[model samples]
Target: MHSFVYLASQSPRRSQLLEQIGIAHRLLVAQDHDPEPQDPEALEQVLPRESATDYVQRVTGLKLDAAIARLQRRGLEQAPILCSDTTVSLGRHILGKPESQEQAREMLQALSGKTHRVLTAVALQSGRKRLTSLSVSSVEFAVMDSAQIDAYVASGEPMGKAGAYGVQGRAAAYIARISGSYSGIMGLPVFETANVLRAAGFAI
Candidate 1:
């Protein structure tokens, strides 16, 4: 079994999720590389339109590929690598992290009193083998007023999270109910993540 897996995401939520399951991991942040969302034109070009699941999976694969290249360059090919991406979906539309306070407020208003799906994709790569898994969770938000949205936006928690909200943070008060893995909605699905790691020959 591998001693530890290389996590290529910078989200503390992912790291906490891994630790929650007792999975030993080391951060493998892509130095000097900025992770950007797919261009609007490119995203619109996907045939038949990509579902939230497809979007997250594609992004996760791209990050894993990048991490693998980085590892190879660093001469650390022996360790398995893990990468994940999360996105919020309202029907066919994908909602990524907000770029500004206004965007966050808009996202929150759009989600007010509605049910949205959160999709998280995890990828594990070890030597010549690779595995991927996805977790989907539905979250229902209560009707949120502008005051609440403003306060949350000012907190700065929504800036780096999908759907411009964090279920485990202050936004929890706005969430009326959740019907899936909480950890998954947070960014990393613990159940699927553990399975991928074990399948990739990493001992949890």
Candidate 2:
């Protein structure tokens, strides 16, 4: 087992989840000086006609591939690298992070008193081997008044989150119930993540 693995994610919740399982990890984010730095943030564009599950899985794989190359470029210590991505879907329609307050409010209004699917895809890459997992959770949102949606959007927490909300944040109040992995809803499913890490020869 490696002393620690590289977690190529920007979400603090992913890091917190890994720590919960006692897996030592280091962030593997893009450096400002890279000759060919790809904007990790921009890799999340929803493809034309892509389904939610397909979108999350593809993004996660792309992220892992990028991280693997980064590890090689940085000459970092050899260890499995983990990457994951999450997306919220109302049926076939994907509700990504809102680009504006109006969009956020629209997403919130659409989700009010409705159930949505949150899909999180995770990948672990160790040299020539890779393991992957996907977690799909059902989240039911309570009906929210326009005022409530406006207030939440004003808080700015909905800007960069899937479905314009976070399960563990202020948005929790709007979540009537979740029928899947809570940790998955938070961006990393501990059970699935641990399983992949273990498969990649991590101690966890």
Candidate 3:
């Protein structure tokens, strides 16, 4: 197994996923950073006109670049650095993390009784080499009532989660079906992540 890698993400779920796979990773959170979406009234504004795959890949690359620069500055550039980003997409519109409980409710309502795609992009950087992988999962949600949405919103679990829901939390009760990696839905695609890590010299 690779001795250890740097993980540039703040999501506990992502960290847990890595631990579940027995991958030794050191957390490398961005300092005083905010991931708020850029100016726009709609989620699509934050995403480029490119296809979903391309959009995710590009963002992952950018994140990897930032992380790599940080590692280099710290003289820890020898260890592999992993960066990932996840987005919940309804058609061409990307539903990112909600900024408020009201926003979370709206996102959940839109996702009610519908099938949406969850795209997770993973990037691994080691020295001058960088590799990226994408995982897309189709998720179906049952129709949720306002009461359910309100209660979930009150629980405060949707605030920092993409799509205003977490598959590993209470939101799991609302998922009707999933056609791809559950770990991917939770913010990391274990299978693809492991593949990339192994390819980058990490012992699985």
Candidate 4:
């Protein structure tokens, strides 16, 4: 079994989640200080008429492919590589990370007093084999007035989060309930991740 795996995500929550499961991992992220860092956002653009399930899975696959190439280019030690992507959706509308505070508020407003699906797609590359899993959870938010929405947006917790909120952050106050894996909503589904890791020949 591999001693450790490479995580290709910049989210602290994902790293923390892996640590929580007693998994040792090294970051395989593209450094911001690079002379020409790749545009990360370009990989996340929602294609026309794409479903949330398809989008998250495709992005995760793409990210894993990039990480594999990155490892080869850097001549790093080979091991399993993991990548994940999360998306929030209400009905057919997909809500990604908010670009600005105003957009964050708008996303939050749309989610107020409503339940939405939080879908997290996880992909792992072990040698020539690839494995994938998806965790779908439902989050219900309490009705929020404009003042509450404004306050949450001002705190900036919603800026970089899907559906303009974080289940593990201050937004939990207004989260009426969650119907599925909390870890999945937070970014990485623990159960799914462990299963994928085991399939990748990593001792999880």
Candidate 5:
């Protein structure tokens, strides 16, 4: 059993989720000055005709691969490494993080009075072994007028969140119903993550 794991994600929610489970982990984020850096934006680019499930899982795998390489490059101590990716989709349309307030407002408007699927994929690498899991949740937003959408966007909470909103933030007021893991909607699924960690020989 390992004493701790390495989490290769910039999302503080993921880290908070891990902490909630009593899992000790250190961030293994890439540095700008690294000789070989992974471009997060490039890695998250949606491919033509890609399904939400495929996109989230593929991105998680790619992130794990990059993290594994990062560990080797840094000669870090041997331990399990965890990586995850989340995407919000309404049918075939994948809603990624909004680049600007206008985009955020547009996403919020589209999601109004509708239910969308939030898919989160988690991957773990331990020694020569790798494991993965996916969690899918549905969130329904109540009908919102332009003012409501604009108010939320003005709060700036949707700027860096997938689906242009965070379930645990001010956006929660507009969430009429949630049919899946709340933690998953926040960017990490605790149940799925704990299972993956256990599979990787961690004593979650």
Candidate 6:
């Protein structure tokens, strides 16, 4: 068991969650100079007829593979490498990060007074072995008028988050209820994350 592992994600929230659980991890994010720097965003493009579960798992595995290769390229010492991916789904439709303010508004409006699924997949690579886990949670939203949607969009909090809103932010005001892991909706599910880490032989 190692004292710390490599976390290959750009989300600050993931780092904070790991710290919250007393897991020491080193950030192993992709750099602009990386050989496949564009792979991060490219991997997220939804495939034709891809279910949310498959998409999240596939993307998480891809990220782990990339990170494993990256670690070897850098000649870094061997330790478990972790990666995660999250997506919002309304039925089979995957709601990705909004490209514009209007799109953000549309996503929020569509989610009003409805239920959606938030799926987060975590993958861990230890030596030549790999492990993965998934967390699925349902969220119910209160009715939001046009004004509410517009104001939330204007806050600029929906731009980079899946489902056009962050669960830990102002959007929580409109969430009437949630039926799964709150940490998963925030980007990384600490429970599933800890499972993979322990499976990879981490002391945590």
For each candidate, what is the lDDT?
0.84, 0.89, 0.84, 0.92, 0.92, 0.90
Best by TM-score: 5
Measured against the true structure, the TM-scores of the candidates, in listed sequence, are: 0.90, 0.95, 0.90, 0.96, 0.97, 0.96
lDDT of 6 by residue, 134-190 (tens): 999999999999999999999999988999999999999999999999999998899
Pairs in clash, predicted candidate 2: none
- lDDT, residue 33, candidate 1: 65
Q: Per-residue lDDT for 126 in model 1?
A: 85
The segments of candidate 6 whose C-alpha lies over 4 angstroms from its true place after superposition are: 35-38
Worst 10 residues of 5 by lDDT: 31-40
- How do the residues 1-204 of candidate 4 rate in per-residue lDDT, one tens digit apiece? 799999999999999999999999999988656422346788899999999999999999988888988888789998899999999999999999999998998998999999999999999999888999999999999999999999988888997788889999898999988999999999999999999999877676
Compared with the true structure, what per-residue lDDT tens digits does model 1 show for residues 47-102? 36677777788878888887887776777646888988888998777898888899
Better of 2 and 4 by TM-score: 4
lDDT of 2 by residue, 70-139 (tens): 8889898888899899999997899888888999999999999999999999999877888999999999
* Model 5 lDDT tens row, 40-90: 789999999989999999999999999989999999998889999999999
Off by over 4 Å in 2: 35-37
Query: Lowest summed-lDDT stretch of 10 residues in model 3?
Result: 36-45
Better of 4 and 6 by lDDT: 4
lDDT of 3 at 165: 95
Q: Predictions ranked by TM-score, top down?
A: 5, 4, 6, 2, 1, 3
Winner on lDDT between 3 and 6 is 6
lDDT at 139 for candidate 2?
96
Model 1, which residues run further than 4 Å from truth? 33-48
Of models 3 and 4, which has the larger TM-score? 4
Which segments of candidate 4 are over 4 A away from where they belong? 33-38
